[model samples]
Target: MVAFHASALDGVARNPALPTPLLLRLLAFDGGGDGPPRYAPQRAGLPESAVAVILAHPNPGARVDFAMSKLAEPAQRARLVDDPSPKVRAALAYGPEWGDPRASVALPDDVCARLLDDPDPSVRTALLDSPHLAPSFVASLATHHDPAARQVAARAWEKLAPDERLALLTDPDPEVRRVAALGQCRRDAHLTAELLRDPQFAAEALRRGLLHRADAERHVAERTHLAALAENPSLPADLVERLAVDPDEGVRLAVSLRPELDETRRMAIDFTVGDLDRGDGVHWVREGLADPEVLRRAATSAHPLLRRSAARSPHLPPDLLHLLARVEDPVVENRLGIHHPDTPEEVLMRVYARLGGTFSAWMAETHPRFPREGLAARYADHPDGNYRRLAVRDPAATPTLIERLSHDPTVWTRQAAVGDPRLPLHRLREALHVPELASSAGANPALPEDEMAAVLNRAGVPA
Candidate 1:
């Protein structure tokens, strides 16, 4: 055994791919089962003779190690069933051998039965990880004193009879019940009714169309279930219609966001003119006000809030959009800029003129319909550096204008100038000499490869 450990260590040091049989032989001789065994020999990789030698070892620790080896035959494993050491039996009961199908002793009924009665909680818990564990054994674990063991048993829910599944639904352990409620057991009305009382199961119950209208209503009334109830396909249309006008804004908003919207249901939710014109309230009504007449009323309302909300509707007539565009309120103008993408060039020009140089005006100027001619030049000398930067980035920027900005004292403008695709390669090379522009100029794709290398070399940066 000492020779085998030394030879195994030598083989590992030299080849590193030393076979499992050699390693298991070394483990059998190591005398180190002070804690649970850590390694399981692969059955396919180790010869049966090696498994026999380890199984017959005088050291209980060696027997414990061999008991868990996947290579141990069922009859050989059975011999350890009554072994004097609990640790050896425990190792046999919960080891990798039970989980692997190719292992000769994998999930044998007798072995599982023996482990089930074993005092070790770990052995019982480990038994649950077996895919081949019988339903009867799983049923026996349902009443396990350990909550964790009961939870593990709950995972075999599909294999449990309906009566057995129903019994677990009322299990003292909430986790066990949670698992049971989500299992494949028949979700009859009784089970549904019982689960509906718990918020955790209520959402899933609603999703599966298990709850009746009265039960669903009770669940939805709770703030916790409002969002889930909205998403529940089983929610009755009448209830959905009722929920649309629910006093809770959150509940109403949840209803509004549902994927399917029928016309009657749409009208029932008051997102239109008569509803309170709260700023966020507009979002709830946005989808409902699809009619052109409703949108026009909203667009023309005395309240700028309603008008701003109305401006967001895609159905608004062009005339209403033109009118909203000319409204002096910055909020209304900004909303128009965002929602009125198809605004006529004349209206955009008029809005830009009225708004002066505000962000909304800049948005108008950047619109594709707005004339590009002289636009960049107009903002090029604007006092705001942001406008100047935008002007430098404009497609209308001329080579001379780009070069002028390249020498601007502002580092950002200079950076923008160096980044311009139209900057001549020769000008880019010259700009590299300016320390501030050097990094940006060097990184520019237009800079010649040789010149980029020289610049990087001068900066002491490795290629």
Candidate 2:
């Protein structure tokens, strides 16, 4: 009899109750009978029989694992290596005996096969991490109809032969296909080149290849593949278009920003921005939105993302805001800052109001080339109070308009009037006295104190 204690598990075993000799004999063997054993062993000094009873006891899982881990002998430990209970097997797997093939017990082939099929994924994960798992066994797992097993096989693929690795390239599962793609990228260069040339596989392969290779040969191959893929008319147009719109800003910038594009092709793709399939919608929205011809085409495109992209075109001339104003989509309409007669006065007013600060701030932060003064002046006299308010904030805002809006009943209108940079200091002082206009003075930091003061005076406040 002995008391067991270790630093690793802290003091969990310090006071464990020791099983009686009779109970220990029952646990150490499969054959058993009958009921409660009498007289448990004394709690402090545990006998070897007590340890055997603890390892084999059919009670809670935690207790079984704790006891098996405490066992130190080979024959006793081998007794559990293939225990029918996965919990018992797992406990053995986690034990120090796991690394010693000499201690390995022969697992039933059927049991190993069933474990390979376990619906629980972690069981298989444990299998792969085991030392020198047989390649034949792993090969069977790789082709397993179960997507999870195939994925596991795909990961530890260096052990697989080229053909065996290539077999998974068309796996039914997307994740499997992705993993197979990674494996394919490394082992078989010929297959990788084939994938890079196949339009269907080129995009996915290129995306994965970039992660694997970086030297000059790989770079040249990648460029040559992209340029060749770009010209393949038989390739799906949408995929090609995606290439044209590659999320890599560098790629998008390259196509649209290229100075070498012939005027004819550039203009042709520009005009096609609205052509349902040929519409260089992405590049058009990227570069052509400034041209009226381009905006009209983009405004009519059926694609929503393209339409949204078109709306963001900042290069549109001032006079074109009227045409863009007619776009039915609010997303595009808002981006164009249209103030047309058909546009609801409310929306027009919001657009105008946004121009001075909210609009300008967003533009400067996200899209730097937004032309501010010219656009604001175009709508200075808009009938909507919101538009009038925005006009007042523009650097181009006039004194006469400031004086008129200072008296306007709408608080927002009065605020805009008081914030006008064009208003004389006396007029701004006057406007500041009006209670409704007072708070409007400091609302926009962009509205200089001198301009706000001029608006305050115009509203009849003393400055």
Candidate 3:
């Protein structure tokens, strides 16, 4: 309302899981701002009333932003099918659940028919490569006029029948053949030997099951292919030993972290440990986590990233959690505190005490085991507002300290205080008028039912 601030809209967007109608009024007031629409507020699974607010609006930019986000239904998003803006139409081509890796949303059949032949070539291209598409849709693209579209069909080789796969693999387009080759190599092992000798495809070919002892011996020294060979789960054990001593420090480093190697054998190898922060979870780890043995192996891995990944499992047992606690990395300790229920109070304190728990304040309030006794007294007088904010976690916190923090200089700490039940009702009401504090204050469970409804009424919702 005050010069179209993004926070007014994004505060609702950032917590899409909340059953709230705030996004409706914010978008209604702003008309979705200038230029292209942002995606944050339009996430899939938002309440129908919130989604209707945007869908019922006439703003092309708002509709475009909505197209790029997850949707409540395929038909809901498909309403934008004949939109005038080419960009809006193109955004719809990305289909449902845009960035979600675990689930794909299938567009309604009627919508898919329209988008398949959209006037904009760019839209058609996006539809061709869109996630959540069925295999049959990809198979039908095998003979599309656009070679790029045909290339997308080729990548879906497993989904295609043998004859259909052969047609795309033999397509006249060189690039299409290349994109299809890696997948096809897995289907036909005999073809791998030929591809292995070709420099253009050798690295990919080396990772296949077709790579025998002779193949490993031959390509083991090819520096370009070492990383691929190192990644191959089926790589020969003797070859693993040979690569463990390879001249390339990168190869030796990779071999040292192989999950199959015992800690003693792995530590004995001379290798440079990679210092970059590797991110959480590998696909293989997720696939194999069902087996208790796999989880135990990954939890105790010499690779720090693998251990960090195992720490994310809610099912991780106590002994493994303790084993990870001994790991020297502070981030690993934070992962434990964030996920595992059995993570002890001292470990949580250790992580927050070291890292200030910058992005993970939820633990202080909701973690069942977080030490509540004396929490307020320990941190209420701390000079660092970040640490002082911990006082709000205790229900028995003195009213004087809660009042002081409700107006703390740091916004994060201030927001936390505004949501605490110990905060005076008058201060919580005051926060509802402050633009930056309104969303958190509105969501506070401590706020009375009628007062919460009144706050929503002010935001233009029916109380």
Candidate 4:
């Protein structure tokens, strides 16, 4: 509801470019209700004056919002550490939750260090969740009075020294000891060998550590063991070969998808693939990329799967793109058309026309390369109403056509039309009454500043 927050005023409070004087008043402004401040403290370009107002505001709500905001300069962190409310301090201590406005910002390390010694247990507990803690601090968490904190440190057991890891193995807490055992088994071959003798620990060891060929071979008769072996990225080439022809179809399918194999070898394996989805689904999602030769060979490979894999490489050189373009696969075109920097203008349009409603098509429709010249005139009366909506993107689109499209039978076409700055002011105002277009109208850039302030005034905000 627009009435939910006093300053909610359409989206003005969310604007990063609002002048500092107005922003200060909004930060401290309380309009008789207890709703949290809608004015986002994390919005960029906040001046020091705005920060000072947020810190001194009588309402703790705005202060808490600023506490979790990523904007605090390193020098300003100490003041935040001393915030009057524990709730605010806890917000500062813990990183923002996923949907919080502040989640994307980095809280300074100095602030985190100060919060490490916070008197409140809640504040201390929140600190443990923050990834920004210093390495030494995480290592010392092993001895924290709280067992929960110690258990968290066990997850980072590799950071501990050899003697420290040994100490954790014998810790009084059984849960801590169990988590630590995985680390120890992976680190010490002798301990791993001992643990393998027990069936329970052996299964965990297979999942967590690289296995010698003899140990790996010992487990292959069971379908469950073969599945684990094929799923393990650490499985050596010889182990992959041994699992390749195992009687279980699931095991072979798992091997076929492993990062180590190319298209030809994968097709030769014993499994039948169901749906062939994006080739980059598994390994290419990581920071490290497939080798240049792998990508090049895949780009030129006869397998549609390999070509799709090559298209997923954002760093594909021009030569590979040229090769893949000739292949003309829809999946390959989807990946390259929207994501690759060097995709041709013709490809962008073709992808937009062919792959409608798909993620790539949406991206391609808005892409700078899609020709904008006289687009409104060309697509204005297109039989497909969806295509007529493309006119809104053309700079040549007249206010008259924008007005006509604002009443389009296709609802999205109308919503997109009203959002277009070229839509006449009268039509944009009318859109505010249509539920579907209300949000789009309120956020429309064409809504003049004074008109926005008037809307806020009517909504109960003081001038």
Candidate 5:
């Protein structure tokens, strides 16, 4: 049999008139050592019986290869749509040829219907891309149980009937409704009003002009709706002003931070210390508070939480920051350490002198103008490992100081020394045998390429 198949291959290669089934059988055989058969027939030229034989091949690879080939008849491709193999169906569904409307023109309605109910979501999704799919069938898949299918249907939203689009507005899937709301609800005021009741769709509706002033007035009464409404940039100034004091601190805080608020409106908006208790509200208010006076008041408020909130404000005056620095509160101290750029130099020096024992390491590593020289000199022999590490990383660190730090008992200090640009290659070479320092030493640009290559090669690593 093997000899016969081998001879058939040579004959088919020599003559084009050989039967395609014989050519396909030879191609499907796994010629272990004799090398693969050479007869390759184009799908369009293959007989229907030959195409069927390829599709029926037990190996999915053979079926996929054939499905991916060009077929002369849509019916031939349609026959495999219900082949009980999801992968086979998927290949036909997503094939580029099906993207052209003419390729699906001869496909029977029963075949298109079976593809719509295909168990694989990907097959259903790819079916939606077929230009010849009926509008009614596309609409049916719009609410298909699979969110992925509905997501595809949402892209064809404009082609769906008005009622079909409305049905999807409340589809169980949030993503499906979100897509539908953005595409279909913009022009229908009634549908827009209905979607506004759902917080997920409210903001999009308002931004698209689907929600009018009356809709905003009616929906603003609901707190859930207020969050989305607060983000709408086009809300009337008067309505925004009304919402600025909507009794819900969330609403007030949202309104206060809107960039659309003019100077007078922003200044007029009020937030009590209680508003700072809501973590999210305070975060947004702190980020948006531009009024120096409000920030100053919050900075000096008797309530520590309120003061902490104010201290976090990026817009706080440098003078207020200096004042807040002296409060001795950990929260206030940490905030000051991070926002120290605008603080007065004298205040920074004073804070460094007073709390240098506690925050010196962090300040040295992070502060732009941190007294690197002062800290290095002051903490050169500090007992704290972090302080020692910071000293090694400081710009004032001498090569000798780094060399001494390289021999520190702590691995962290050794790791820090490995990263220091001033560490001599000789010192790095000494540390290479230490497994912990290998990665850092290997990455150092100062290490000679040839030396690093030799070190990595000795460690059984590719250079």
Candidate 6:
């Protein structure tokens, strides 16, 4: 499909090994059929690489396209770029890395400016990675309102000055903040410390209303900023003391886990540990009780959570747990059961799964009132693969339940039966061998095409 002018070639003959039809068609406007032959490339004789490069090079001048692909020297690349073909310019603007220093640096300033706003994403990506681009110019582009442009700009923003860095930090867009926070700002001790020290930094960050989707995300940002300061073990003692008593559980949790916790800070931790709102206070107290005296003091507290936390601690006396086991508050009892699922099998099975503890033994045991049928159904039908797998292994599980699950519409449910205890070996073999069921079983969650084929292979079913 290579275009050859009848007049340009010594004798006209189609080259069977010519470039693709599209490339030929792209050249047709210049020479083939009734078109003028002035633009034909035979004047220079097309290079071997030119033909291969032009095959995928969008319709335009071959030289510029090759230059854009970085197939030529920087001088050659710069020369061909002036070709009066927007297609060529577009390709050069967005083309693959040429690695030619001049290709990035020698680009006309106007063209470089235009490339910043290029509609094609590839062109913008190429421009962003261009080492020749000035930092100031790149910074201007990085603050672009367009997300794709901004994202490209972020990659370039890594080399910006501290003042410019602050500009991006305070960018109006959350995407900008998120990328900045996670990528660049995360490594800046000065920036992160400044954010932690500034009383209005969190408020300003929150007010800018970037990525405040959840309380946890806010907590994470706050924690990240605080951690930036906490990493400095020589952090001011007053700052450490204030943070130790911070109302946020995450902050207190940070304090509790901080290696810097000393006697004065330990007293602060004790006070903070006593504050229930500071995230599972009992947890901190129990974990804090690596000191035997602390455990003893915590064990005698009137608060049940503290006492239960004390009982659950490996360092605490086992006799303390026996004493609390008789107190009768269901909440505390549930915690004890949850914490000691292996130690107190009888009481653990008595509590509900929703109350939060290992439920394998509970599922195996038949409760007189609620019965196991619904829970069994959830186990077989649950979206989570692990839960379903666990459910199928229970002794209370029956063949009927396994069969229902084996043919269930959902692949996860059906696959659950492969390792199920209730399904007989023959049933498993049959399920694996049946082409339709087996194909469905092994099919990719996205494409179901040879879905049946894939499932059969996985289930040992014949294609």
TM-score of each: 0.38, 0.29, 0.68, 0.68, 0.41, 0.28
Greater lDDT among 1 and 5 belongs to 5
Kindly give the stretch of ten consecutive residues in candidate 4 with the minimal lDDT sum.
98-107
lDDT of each: 0.59, 0.46, 0.67, 0.67, 0.60, 0.46
List the lowest-lDDT window of 10 residues for candidate 5: 33-42
Model 6 C-alpha lDDT per residue in residues 250-291, reported as the tens digit of each score: 555455544435444444463333323322444346446456
Candidate 1 lDDT over 274-314, as tens digits, reads 33334543533464456776676566655555576776665
Which residue pairs in candidate 5 have backbone atoms (N, alpha carbon, C) closer than 3 angstroms, thus clashing?
none
The candidate with the higher lDDT, 1 or 6, is 1
Q: 1-463 in candidate 2: lDDT tens per residue?
A: 0111111011112213212432343233221221111112112345666645655556524333432342244334445444556655554433333322113333333444555555445555554455434455666667777786687678767667767677778777887776777656644545555566566766545433422233213533355455333333233434445556544443443333223334443333422223123223354355565576766555554544455566565555545444555655555555544212233344444443445446423332223223346535765566776555555645665677677777765667776666555665566545444455544433333344343334323322232
Please give the clash total of every predicted structure, in order.
0, 24, 0, 0, 0, 7
Candidate 1 Cα RMSD after full superposition onto the native fold (Å): 20.9
Local error of candidate 6 at residue 452 (angstroms)? 59
Provide C-alpha RMSD values for all models, in order: 20.9, 27.2, 5.9, 5.9, 19.4, 20.3
Tens-digit lDDT track of model 5 for 1-463: 3332333233232233444433454445444433223233223566766666656766555555455454436666667786767877876665434322113333455676687688787777667665555555565677566786687677677678777787787788888877787776657667677766666666667644355778777766555557557655557778787888788876666666564455566657675544243442343336545678667656665545546667655567767877787776655655555554554444455555455455433452356655455556866687866567768746788889888888877777777787566888788766655566654554454655454435423422221
On lDDT, who's better, 3 or 5?
3
Cα TM-score of candidate 5? 0.41
Give the Å error, residue 34, model 1: 44
Candidate 6 yields a Cα-based lDDT of 0.46
